[model samples]
Target: MQQNSLKLNSDKTQLLLIGSKSTLTKTNNLTLNIDGISVSPSHQARNLGVIFDSTLSLEPHIRQLVKISFFHLRNIAKIRPSLTPPTAEKLIHPFVSSRLDYCNSLLYGISNTSMNKLQLVQNAAARLLTHTKSWHHITPVLKDLHWLPVSHRISYKILTLTYKALHQLVPPYLSELLSPYQPHRSLRSTSARLLFTPTSKLRSFGDRAFSRAAPKLWNSLPILIRDSDSITTFQSRLKTHLFSSAYP
Candidate 1:
């Protein structure tokens, strides 16, 4: 009887979730779409802000690249969030030659307007981290990201969601606000390793607090937070992009 009740509740939840396509598509469980067509409705839905678990069909290599790129971007922004474009690039240049796989994808696949996207992702990460209150829980899952096979749009949204999800684990000020608990050298070492190394372990957690909060949080953000293509351009395009069922 207890087993049946659990199954019944689970079925009802799935039905309620998928019944709303916009909500349905935002889930982190990636259903393989070797061809981009599967995401047509998602692309059009203009709600591309879903993260995925490694259990998804995505390849391991792409997952690794995505993880490396995510923290790298975060570290770059945090290191000197004030650096000028050219100077930032100069500091960024060394990493450009990284043997990491996404060099070509980030350059070729991501849109020119990604700076805004980065900011938005950062904001999302900040918000998510605030609620999470711990970094270890989020680190392990984040170690899995990729820009290649995941496709540009998919990677963009996935990264954004990942930031937001992990942010829920720790704090937005986490990267910025230093822990006095650690000595300066240890802090620097930890920062460098998290930023530079690809194989390092990020902390992980198993909690449903995120599940309860993410939908409301996502709904609160704009139809699109960043200008992957252009502010005005994507604004117009996303409307036509979504189905007749679309709404905030």
Candidate 2:
């Protein structure tokens, strides 16, 4: 920072330590001194509009998302009666859907409880748009809206990035994390268009990383989708595959 002539704003700067639960516990109440300025570790920190907790559980981020989404949902509900369904959907997309989808690829492999909370927000949004009662099943409403559930949406985002990375469309930093699978000898699975998945010792946290998750999701995809010739085609086929699984 000094070499770049950038001054550190100690008051605005936040220190966050990320690790598993047990590892975080060891660093409880930890603080740092930088250039005689004392900085304490924050339980959560915001970066690029995404909140990251020490444990990387993302529960705090989910709670914030739920709160903000419902706030917009309530405001939209006030004018829902006057606006047509299409107009309401447009409004919801910018206010709610964008927030849900923004940086959501980072949410892969989160706890089911956290995922469920997000699903409820999407369900409420769908219900608001369609005027569906709470008692009615949400799956059909979501399907009718052509919406993928929260979990599938996360998967969609990850798989899309993976596709881009594999095709050299993304930055080299991300693309380099993945490698084309090469076996010692050609076999029946050689044409599968799979990426090499590295073994992760820390299943709980390490497996959720992009290096592990990307290949796992990519390899699990059908060969047809994996062999897509273009980004547009890959996304279309990928959405269709996930939508079927989500609604079926």
| Leading candidate by lDDT | 2
Q: Candidate 1: worst 10 consecutive residues by lDDT? A: 193-202
Tens-digit lDDT string for candidate 1 (20-139): 334455676544332232321222211122222322212233344445556665677585546654565454435522323232222222333433333333333432323334434433
lDDT of 1: 0.34
Worst 10 residues of 2 by lDDT: 26-35
lDDT of 2 by residue, 1-248 (tens): 88999988888889999887878778756788876899998889999889998888888889999999999999999999999998999999999999999999889888888999999999999999999999999998899889999899999999999999988899999999998889999887777888889898887688899999999999888899999999999999999999989888
How much is the lDDT of residue 160 in candidate 1?
A: 45
Give the candidate number with the greatest TM-score: 2
| Candidate 2: Cα lDDT at 241 | 98
> Each model's TM-score?
0.20, 0.96
